[model samples]
Target: MSGIEELDEDRLGALAHKLDRPLVLIGLMGTGKSTIGRRIAGMLGLDFVDADDEIVHASQRSISEIFDEFGEDYFREGERRVIARLMTENKGVIATGGGAFVNDETRALILKQGIAIWLDCDIDTLVERTSRRNTRPLLKQGGPREILTRLKEERSGAYSRAQVHVVTGDLPHHETAMQVLEALEKWL
Candidate 1:
């Protein structure tokens, strides 16, 4: 589909059927991965799984609680394991935690077993979007702008390795979702 208007559910489902691996979204926090993943799943008639939510479910604790209790290294190990398991067990769209794709082991596994899509966003946009939520443990440690900027810079290299890259912005979620769908059309 060229645009949202041209996208029909049947057409989306057809594209989804052509997919052989889980579509993993890699990006910094507040890049609309979860929201857009859900939209993509609904459009494609595929199941949706958020890696962070799955991590929460598997650990029986909030992500903040995990980080606060066990620290980032411990939380990351669990994240890597959780993501690896999700890759094998899930065949739909997976919206990963921001740091998930940045880990060496997790990035390698995702690259091998999943179709990676990098949802890139500007530092300004990230700051604005992330402000809507105060539960981000990383942001709690420092200023959101500085933290997000450093994160976007540090993670860009890993994210660039994704099979497909979509530069997203402050547009409506559906517009971005349609853009992703259109990109996947060319991809799958």
Candidate 2:
């Protein structure tokens, strides 16, 4: 959790006060949105809500199970609703599912009601990170690299509309969060 530079708490407070809406993170999976969002929220003294978790809670099923029981379309509809509700109910950091922002309604809602930050990383890193989990329905059918690569190509257009874009390399999660904090400072 050690970062290269010590974060300035006073600066974080100032930035947090400047926030007008939720900080919504949009990206492909394995981009560290949940982890970095938690760090950023802690640093800013804000709440952290993972939209995926909310979806699971509301549905009473895991994401993969939801996909298995219904389908991607059904899951997406629920995801949009969940994200919209979160936007209205929480003025904090929100980490969205990879495909959530691809939904037109969800994308529009985030762009209008929150500061969207897109986190991206290389395919190799994505494969490695996503390998740790077996819960991703999208990757369940194909090779993770191929699915992830195609996902990036298809979703980059929507994700590119984010207010801020950060590419995370081999940095530690804390450093990646620091980068997001710096980007937010500059954007705000």
Candidate closest to the true structure, highest TM-score? 2
User: Where does candidate 1 have its weakest 10-residue lDDT segment?
Assistant: 1-10
What is the TM-score of candidate 2?
Answer: 0.96
Please give, for residues 83-117, the per-residue lDDT of candidate 1 as tens digits. Answer: 99899998999999999998999999999999999
**Residue-level lDDT tens digits of model 2 in 81-107:** 999999999999999999999999999
Off by over 4 Å in 1: 1-4
| lDDT (0 to 1) per candidate | 0.91, 0.92
Query: Where does candidate 2 stray beyond 4 Å?
Result: 1-7
- Candidate 2, residue 5: the lDDT equals 65
Clashing pairs in 1: none
> In candidate 2, where is summed lDDT lowest over 10 consecutive residues?
1-10
State TM-scores per candidate: 0.95, 0.96
